[model samples]
Target chain A: MPKTKAVDLVVVGAGPAGMAAAVAAAEAGVEKIILLERQAELGGILPQCIHNGFGLRYFKEELTGPEYAHRFVQELKKHPGLKVKTETMVVTITPDRKVVTTSATEGLVCYQAGAVILAMGCRERPRGAINIPGTRPAGIYTAGSLQYLMNIEGFLPGRSAVILGSGDIGLIMARRLTLEGVRVKAVLELMPYSNGLNRNIVQCLEDFQIPLYLSHTVTEIFGEKRVEKVRVAPVDKDFKPIAEKGFDLSCDTLVLSVGLIPENELSLQIGVELDPATGGPVVDSFYQTTVEGIFACGNVALVHDLVDDVSTESALAGRAAAAYLKGEIKTKRWLPVKAGRNIRSIVPQRIVVGQTTPLYIRARYPERNATLHVGDGQTKQQVVSPGETIYYTLKPEDIRTADGWVEVSLEGGRVHD
Target chain B: MTELTCIVCPVGCRLKVEQGKEGLKIIGNGCRRGVAYARDEMTAPKRMLTAVVQVAGSERMLPVKTETAIPKAKIYAAMEEIKAITVSPPVMIGQVIKENLAESGVPLVATGTIAGEGCFKPLEKSLGSE
Candidate 1:
């Protein structure tokens, strides 16, 4: 026998986003809201992250990942309308707003929500996501998995390691492994520039004497049962590996930190529209997805640079969902937003007219002394990198001016415009 | 000219520290904080060491971090000292797990609380695939 319950809102994944959303909905007077997480604890990846760079924007202080998550998780306990279910796996989501989940304690449970907030976050791109000719070895792992192994499990992956992709996690791991007395041989990135923050590149790589090779990639992996050595090669502009200038290095492990893909099986089940650039569901302002009452925020909607940003975005979704349940938000036509020049993508793909909206964007390339102009509002930035998210506030004046859609374009700093 | 990028914020201004008879002069920093960061980078750098320490009553490891950053050179030594340590029940947040870790005079404090009773089991499963 299964129990089907009705809830005002069902928020998925109890990471920063889901927790924040559920709490916000509760604060907004939504009487029945449930938060679901597969992890045994409420914090999600925060427990393993253990890094101290989080919560600068939201909390106005540098906090470790666990600390940042606890702030919301503690508050979530006080919300009367919110119910948190940890160790619960949501198996399916239907178009009619039904969430089917299975848990050890609550076996075969279903919740019909007035609105569904998808905040399942993201996952690292594994070996299969990319084509690297290699042996199926035991030591291959994603940077995040390696982090969990080392940080939470108290087990180092290997004695020495070679990390592919100099993203934030890989760079942080280089320093972390060194601190743990594990020899990090090198960090290789296929792109000419690193995709991690400038501070991370300096503090994690430069401080540790770790070499970061640009435009380089692992060509082949050589090992019978465990990773023994890897062949490295330089690549051309088109990212085609060149063999002539290739090299080889022996290492016990290979860690991939290439990229993150939003976990969207449930969202797909509901047939929500996804943006190809973000690899998550597309939404208008208020973080409301194309589906009328369905909403999404955090990495499930778009990959944010900071956990603080995730909490901020998820709060809007929660508040808006509560409003939707209370019949407060008036349904209206949504105007789309576009990435004009030197801009990769903009979140909240659409915006509401006559409303103030905060737009999130990233440059397609490295830019210095750049001004991002969206409609009439312009903010000058000292520098903008693909690793960091650039936030622009569209004032009510900017929204009232004219057009149906807003165009975000980066001006100055070698944009070729 | 010793140049270092200030890691305090995302701006990451390349700061120039010129040592002269008049003492140290920092240039190219975006703000006053950047100037301070250059001074520390040029001098002794410090880092807050964060790791997990086993709790006697709980199955999950309690997350511990230095109350303040320790000298950068002392991090590895600190990790070695932390590995052998464990604490018993009712571990409060900010409770010092190890005092003067690595002899740096900085205590390793707990970041997560482990309840005295009704303990939660640690996650033993391997990292899940996406």
Candidate 2:
């Protein structure tokens, strides 16, 4: 039996989100805040991502993933009130805001907090999830796992490879493999438009002359003991393989960069309500979930395309959780924020009518030169060129004037005069 | 007059360019990069190249890339040059390709993987039979 420790706040997973949340909560004058990370180090995925192009929006400077995370870790070190536990896996979170965790050195420990911040981040969808018909091969790997193995572990996955999915990770890996003197046969993307950034497509695949098969997918993988060949085919609009168009290419390795899913097992265990569209928790304007005292942010709340956005959202959650603990936020009406056309999902699904704060929303698909109109149907306020991510600030008085259901819609690509 | 959007940032500022008596008049640029980008878009567009080269006497193709962006017009020429080259194993990172493809004078550089045993090798019998 492990003794339970009581704290003002408990934040799980010390990734960008967890770190940001913890620091924000501590800054909000919350004492006895604990940040737990399952990994041995505090930086999380950022340490394994050595490439630049991070922190541009947040820091206004180009930084490698590690460098961006290092900045946060440095800031966290100066906070005396924050306690960070590394190599600690939080096994379960109770509905009443109790966390049970197992640590290598500590064995088992339980902690109860007035408010909990769920920032477990996200996990890459594995090859198994897609169920590509193939013999279990040794050379197949998830793009993120391969990134860690090659960048951190100093091991090359394979010499000749074919990557599935033109996600940023796979595209970047294609470039990485080309530099390493490896044969990257091709980069296959199921969608007509790449899931990755256009910059990545230019730098990673097009630059390398690595053939990009759009509207295509890996239908089968062939190997007896290790990956020897892969069968790919063109996919229809619905993403199903067109059998006649299949072609087999010889390769030793296959890397899957299918998609990322928000890690919300702990949130589910705690009975937190979830949003099916984003595969994350349903959070209000303040990033608080249906569970009164528990808050969620970062990928655990919704998978953000960029880590900078994750840190920004997590900081808000952390600050809000601290404020909740201090009994600063009081309201009964949490107006629901619904997604409109071309929009995937929005964080802080509901907003307290009288709270003056900015709402951040990421679109599911990329739209060019579009206006994002926000507000109730009758009276709407429009922001021009909403792009992929659109942020708008509304005073408490503005939201109170709306009836119900704040709608976000893409008003074509016409530039507002 | 032609209007182009800058892909450099999320801001995606639309730059309107009109043919001027001197060369080109650019407007609606937000930053210095946008100005440069507009100028480049008018005259010539360049892009960075990263690709694989066949390893001599080995089935593996070494990943290689240009150190900098090359003139967009020369991209096809650069691709042709890359296809014609081959390197031996034991290649090191930052190793320069045999020929410079970019007219800009920047050499194509190797990014980093080295060949190892148990790696992919095309069936040797097929080569001789063919």
DockQ value of candidate 1:
0.34
lDDT of each: 0.84, 0.76
Worst 10 residues of 1 chain A by lDDT: A395-404
> Which number leads on TM-score?
1
For model 1 chain B, where is the 10-residue window of minimal lDDT? B121-130
Residue A320 error for model 1, in Å? Answer: 1.3
Clashing pairs in 2: A178-B63, A179-B111, A179-B112, A180-B112, A180-B113, A181-B62, A181-B63, A207-B50, A208-B50, A208-B51
Please identify model 1 stretches exceeding 4 Å from their true place: A415-417, B9-14, B18-32, B56-59, B116-130
Name the candidate that leads on DockQ.
1
